[model samples]
Structure formats: C-alpha cells, structure tokens
Target: MQQLAFYQSLWATERRRPGVPERPVSERFDAVKADGYHGMAIDLGAMTLEQARATVPEFARTGLGGLLTAFPQSVDDLRPAIRLAKDIGSPFLIVIGQVMPLSVAGMIPVIREWLALARAEGMPLQFETHRDCITNDLFATVQLLDAIPEMRMAADLSHYVVNREMLYPIRPEYRALISRVLARCDSFQGRVASRNQVQVPIGFPQHAKWVATFLDWWTEGLAGWRGRAGPDDTAIFMCELGPPEYALTDARGDELSDRRQEALQIRAMVEDRWKALGA
Candidate 1:
C-alpha cells in the first residue's frame, strides 16, 4: 500500500521573538515526535554538513526519521550533503540549487551533473521549485522540465504563485503550466501563498481563496502521485512553515499567527487528502 509520511521543518522551530529562548534540539525533536510527525527536516541552507551530521544521533535517539533540504551553491556542493544524507539514513534529499546559470541551456549541464551525482551516491534527489533558485522562473522551469525529461521536482507552488504574481481565478496558461509541474512532482511541501506573499495563515478568513487554491492543488497532486507510485512506496509531504521574514510578523516582531498550529493543520489537510484517494 502507498503510505504518506509527514515531516516538520526543523528550521521552522526558530522562535525569533525578542524574549523567547529557542528550544533545545532534543526537545524540538521530542515535540515533533509527540505531535505525530514522522520526521524532522534539517535545512543545509542554514547549517553546515558537520552541523547537519550532529543531529543524526539525536534523530536516532528520538526514533524519528530525518530529511535533508540542501542548498547547493555549486555542482560539487551537493556531494557532501548527499553523502551525509545517506549516512544518516535519510529517504531523500531536496535540493534548492543556488547555482544559477544565465539561460535554460546553461542550466541543463548543471542539473545533469547533480542528477548524475545523486545517482552515483545511490540517493534520491529532488530539485525544489523555489524562488532565488535555478527553478526560479515559472516559464523557465516549464522549459527546463521539457529540456530535461528525467528531472523530478519537489513542488512548492507558493513560490510560483508569487513569482508569476498570479491573479484570482488563475489564468488558463498559468494553470496549465502548474498542471505540468504537478505531473512531474514526486513530493510536495505545504505552505499557502498569495500573489504578493510567500507565506500566509491558511485559517485566516482574508486568505481563504489562497488557502482553497493550495488545498485543491495538493489534492490533485496527491491523486496523481498515487496513480504513479508503487504499492510499497511512500509519499512525503513536508509542512515547512518558515520563520521570521518568511513568516509575517507584527510591530513587536511577534508572529501574526501560531505557525505550529498552522503546520499541524496543513499536515491534517494533507492526510485527509491522502485518505480521500482510498486504499
């Protein structure tokens, strides 16, 4: 049977509030495990490979899985992360390639190199569709997908929505492009965004439309994944509600909403979507 595994972003645990002290790593892992999360995501964007490796024993101690989100600034940058991911028993690594080439043609060789590296390491790698990354532009990403048929992606549609400044009742062209993306996506991330904002409170009444849009997309994506996945394969959906600037805050720098609750809600929503697909 196809299974669904939910992960919490370790980076999202940062409470950058003025007076609040950050929780210890063990406590954070305990909290995630207590909340029924299957794993915790370690972001290499903010931590070194050595730093990421330190958390491996903690994950083992907590009996929870670990996932690596790598920010590879160059082709060679991914090798160490891949080795670390394999050493730590991570199911896969998500790459947000910071090595931007000038054109789609220029990007081809870079992507091919990384994919080859992942294969050689015997680790699964998925390029994330994110802003400020190689897959930054929506149109360009579509073109790249066409150019590299073997490329797979981790869908974070929040970036594309903001990248295109998508309007209400999404345009046909944009919807088609997004459909193409969904078709190739092997995993997905949870975050709601409007045309102008990267992360929005899904439960807020003002953000209802954007919330609905994301849920619908997720449902479609999950259904498509189910159709293609093997019987014993599992689909991973990460609840990555970010911290500080990625999260909206008030005058006092306190977050406008409770991210932990929002992340749980997103997890529940995805679980429901997975269940809706039947056994």
Candidate 2:
C-alpha cells in the first residue's frame, strides 16, 4: 500500500551546544530510533565518505531506515555516494549537484548522466532544490525540470523562499510558480522559512502564516503524488530542520527553539495531512 515515512537528519543534531563534544553515531542512531523516527539521513557535505561508511553497521543494528544526501561536484562524483547509500540500503539518494552550469542546456547532460548512472546502479535518485548548486536558482531549476521530463526533485521550499526573497501574502505569480514546483515534487522536505530567514521557530507568533503556507504546499504536493503513483508506492518526507546557521539563533549564538521538538512537530503535521489525503 502507498505510505509515507519520516526521517530525522543527523546534521540537525550538530553543535546543539557550542563547547560540548558531538555525540557518537551509535548514540545518535539510538536517539533517532527512540524519538520514533522511521529513519535517519546523513549529509555527505557534513562528513567524509569514510566517516559515513563507519555508521553502516549502526543502521543495520538499529533496523531503522537510512538515507543519504550527496553533494556531487561533477558528473562522475555520484558513483561513490551511491555505493555508500547502497551499503546503508537507503530508500533513495538525494543529490545537490555542485556542478554549476550557466545555462539550462549545459546542465541537461550532467543531470542525465547522473540519472543514468544511478539507474544502472539500481539506486533511486532525486535532485534536491538547494542553494549554491545547479538547481540553486528558482528560474533555472524550473527551466531544467521542463527541459528534462524524467528529472525528479525533492522539494525544500525553504531555499526557494529565501532565494527569491519572496514577499508574504504571496502574489498570484509567486504562487503559480510554486504550484509548478509542487506539481513536480517526487518528495517533500520540512522547514518553515520566511523570505528573510532560511529557518525560523515554527511556533512563534510571527511564523504562523509561513507554517500554514508550508503545510498547504505539502498537502497539495502529497495529494498530487497519491493521484499519480501506483498503489504500492511509498513517499518520503524528511524533517530537516537544521542546526544554528540554518536555525535562527539568539544573540549568544544559541538556537531559539528546540530543533528536535520542531522536527517532530513537522513530522506530526505531515502525518496528519497525509492521513487526510484518503487511501
């Protein structure tokens, strides 16, 4: 049957305290499993490949799902990342391509090659909408999607919002553009962002509208996926509320909200909306 699963990002747990040592991967996995997440996702940009490989046994021991987000700098760079993801037995691989091609036509071949390689390796892959990558620009990404019909995306609306410096009470043109994005999403990401900030505390009074807006987008995206996907397909919605820098910080450089709690809240919100989509 079609279903959705939630994951917590390992990077989200970073530097929760400035002077304190980071927790071990085994301990982190235990915490993720205890927190009732179905999986944990590791960021390649955050750790060396050897470091990522070291955690494979922990994922095996915990029996939780696994996912990898890769930052590939070239067409051939995806190879090892896919292999590591296979070791973790991830449901899919997310690529934030660092190969910046100035034009859409220039990008087409790079993306097509990555897709072909992943398909040959028997890995499911989707490019993530993020900053400082090939899909970084909103206009360029939309164009790339149209140019390559098979190119699937894992939507992280936070980057796009901040990228566009989107104004609130979103204009009709802005909503239309976002609708095109939602229509093409193969998966959804969790984070509430205003045009000014990349990540904000979800429960704050000022952030409520943005929260509501994100939920609306996710609901529309998932419902659309349900309509098109086969009965047995599964959907993944990862809660990637990142650490300070990604998170809003106080003057002291401390996080303004409990990120773990916010991640869970995002999961709950998505779960509620997914249930109401009807089987």
Poorest 10 consecutive residues of model 2 by lDDT? 12-21
lDDT for residue 258 in candidate 2, whole number 0-100: 89
TM-score of candidate 1 on Cα atoms, chains taken together: 0.97
- After aligning candidate 2 to the native by TM-score, how far in Å is the CA of 5 from where it should be? 0.5
Q: Could you give candidate 1's per-residue lDDT for residues 1-279 as a string of tens digits?
A: 889999888898878777889898789889999999988889988777787888888888988888888999888888899888876678888999999998999999999999998998888888899999999998989999999998999999999999999998899999999999999998899999999999998878989999889999988888989899899998889999999899999888978899999999999888887897774
Clashing residue pairs in all predictions, respectively, total 0, 0
State the lDDT of candidate 2 residue by residue for 54-92, as single tens digits: 989988899888899999988789999999999988878
TM-score of each: 0.97, 0.97
Q: How large is the C-alpha RMSD of every model relative to the true structure?
A: 1.1, 1.1
